[model samples]
Target: MTIRIFRPLRVRDFRLLWSGMTISALGDGIYTVALAWQVYDLSNTPTALSVVGVAWFLPQVASVLLAGVIADRVDRRLLMIFADVLRAIAIGVLGVLSVAGELRLWHVWVLVALYGIGNSFFYPAYTALVPQVVSKELLVEAAALRQFVRPLTMRVAGPALGGAIVAGLGAGAAFLIDAASFGASIAALLLMTARPVIRAEGKTMGSVLGDMRDGVRYVLSQRWLSMTLLAVTFAMIFFLGPVFVLMPFVVKNHLQGGAGGLGLVFAAGGVGALVSSLVMAQRGLPRRPLVVVYVAWALAAFALVGYAEADDLWEAVLVSALSVGALVAGQIVWEALLQRCVPSEYLGRVASVDSFVSSGLVPLSLAITGPIAGALGALVTLRWAGVIAGAILLGFLVVLSAATALQPRPDPGRA
Candidate 1:
């Protein structure tokens, strides 16, 4: 049978969920431009943004295990609603501060921390809920739909809209849009009338840490899944993290521009990523997702190097867009792989592990990127970071494939 990408939308519950999520993503796009500009204005340093990133990421890493546990034990729909409420309050505060002229770097730090906490609860719940909303046969298609909207609406249109808002009403107004989006999302989740299959009934014999340990153990036992996680972990920690954390610096010093310039780069990247997501939706992922992911990373690294070397705005914009396209395409493959291979009962935990590893490295990269750039000069350090990350990703690709060569295919008999 030919694969139908939009098959998941045939379900009423899923249609509502997907539409709400798309609107939320559009708000997120606007928020990104505002947040980046806000961070820069507060400290006049790229390191400041990195610091905000650290504040956001560390809480996510810390809370992911608990988030997974909650997803498994609670009504995931309610949990998601709760998360959206928290985010709405947090972003609303940011909006208030912006209008009051009281927004400071420390305020951004606090807000980011709140946002991260919400994400910790929100992501695992969201991932775990997808399988429940659609049939097993349509899981891949649902995942693809998610991949399409998130990148295209959230990142692509998001940044461009955010740029325009920032240009007109400034970053604060952009944040208000994000707050409103969260409120809208909560309304959507509350209206999800389909009942979800809840897990962890009558099994209250374990500690949270014990549950977390079990989740980690489960991931370790999966041959292909474990390897994919490791590869992604490495890529996020070393390559993608540094590029994003350092790009603002590259924008200001290397590209000779300010907040507007940074917004342009983000917009360019969103454009490229938006196109890539659309392509992935049309053509299901390559069978060798591992190889595809590795190639994307390599291209991404090369693009970062190109960004570092670019002496003009046009060159930087072009490189930024291409690099983002590679990154988003790689993410689609990775996400689909996980959605396909991991069992639904363990999906939340597996996603939690993925979040833990992926997010853990981001703080480290952010913390390190600034100091390294200061010591080695931004472009030189970025170049080295790119080359080293590319080499590591390629090596892991070969090793992981060889290691998993003996693995069996996912059983169609199981959900």
Candidate 2:
């Protein structure tokens, strides 16, 4: 059982892709630590930190639908490589400016916006590309392995290393490392040789807007996919803002901790996610993947309520771990289901819509959370966010349970 989890590594192309993505994830973890700390340091306000979130997500919301169309119509590998190159340039500039002591909050906002643009293109392509690189039998394993390694590196080791470097040196070093990591990912993409999935005969590629509309129509037509996306969108709107915007304040003001403490809290979440990923990798998908997905997410939301009321660093660490573990477990199953069920021609577009819907409201959430927290108090804001998210998930679970269309259909060919 244990050895089977690592079976995906035997595929040479997947091995290279996985290794490169792992390095990139690690760098991203470090980059996140640096970016958040830098923002708070510059303005000493939660609103400023919220601005960072807004800058990153607003661009993504604007372009992600189009990005999905491009992903479906072009070589996903090339799209990913181009996105990486753009991110490398953005991060590299940020690094140079930081080291020269010419960095400003506006500068961070601009660079982060650029990074978000890169992300808009990178994610859909990457999601759609994964299934192409590995055999169908390895789909679940590949997805599990990715979920396991990404959080382990990006969330666990990456944030910890970034925090240390920031404390001992500065944010500049972390930015440089992130830039280099993008270069590594680009190189890996260049080496990969995978043929693009052919479009169905007699199917004409539409304009980007037309393609996006078709994608939206397709998701709405599927009861399970639409409902699942709705649940995720609402959950993220209520959950992500509080965690990203208030966690730093909670660490500094409530716990009286510094960068290292913040990193540890984030790392704790990674630990939990890694553990969950390991379990999923070994066990494979649950017998009832859809039911498990909703239930796990609901549990995760309830666990997040613990974060709102936590009084000490240890309490925060424990709750963060629990929340992330539950979240990641469901996410792994969700990815696998999408890869298994969605048609190859429409996979990129579906993945894009998934990203788009899930993240569409995030910018608004991030933009308002700071003011809401300032008015209502951070603890009150975070607590209510969790409660709302939990309620939404519970509702989703009940509704989905009654939908016969969402029930699992057996695949005799599946391993």
Winning candidate number (lDDT): 2
Q: How far out, in Å, is residue 258 in model 1?
A: 6.6
Best by TM-score: 2
Tens digit of per-residue lDDT, candidate 1, span 1-415: 5447677788887887888788888987788788889888888888888788778877878888888877766678888888888888899999889978999888888888888899899888888787677765565567667776776676667887899989999888889989999877887888887455444447453677787787788788876677767776766656755687777788887778788888788778878866776677666757677688778867887676887888888888898889988887877776666666666656778888878877677656766888888898888878888888777777777887777642335534235
Which regions in candidate 2 have their CA more than 4 angstroms from the true location? 36-50, 98-107, 163-173, 245-264, 308-316, 367-384, 408-415
Question: lDDT per residue, candidate 2, 1-415, as tens digits?
Answer: 2555688899777887887788888899899999988888788998898778889878978888888889889888889988999999999999999988899999998999999999999988888887787766677788878888887777668888999989988999889989999999988888889557668789998888898888888778778888989889888888878878887788778887788888788888888877887788787767788888888888888775787788889998898888889998888888888877776677789898888877787677787899999999988888888899889988987887777766645333323
Report model 2's TM-score to 2 decimal places.
Answer: 0.87
Error of 2 at 357 (Å): 2.4
Q: Cα RMSD (Å) per model?
A: 3.9, 3.3
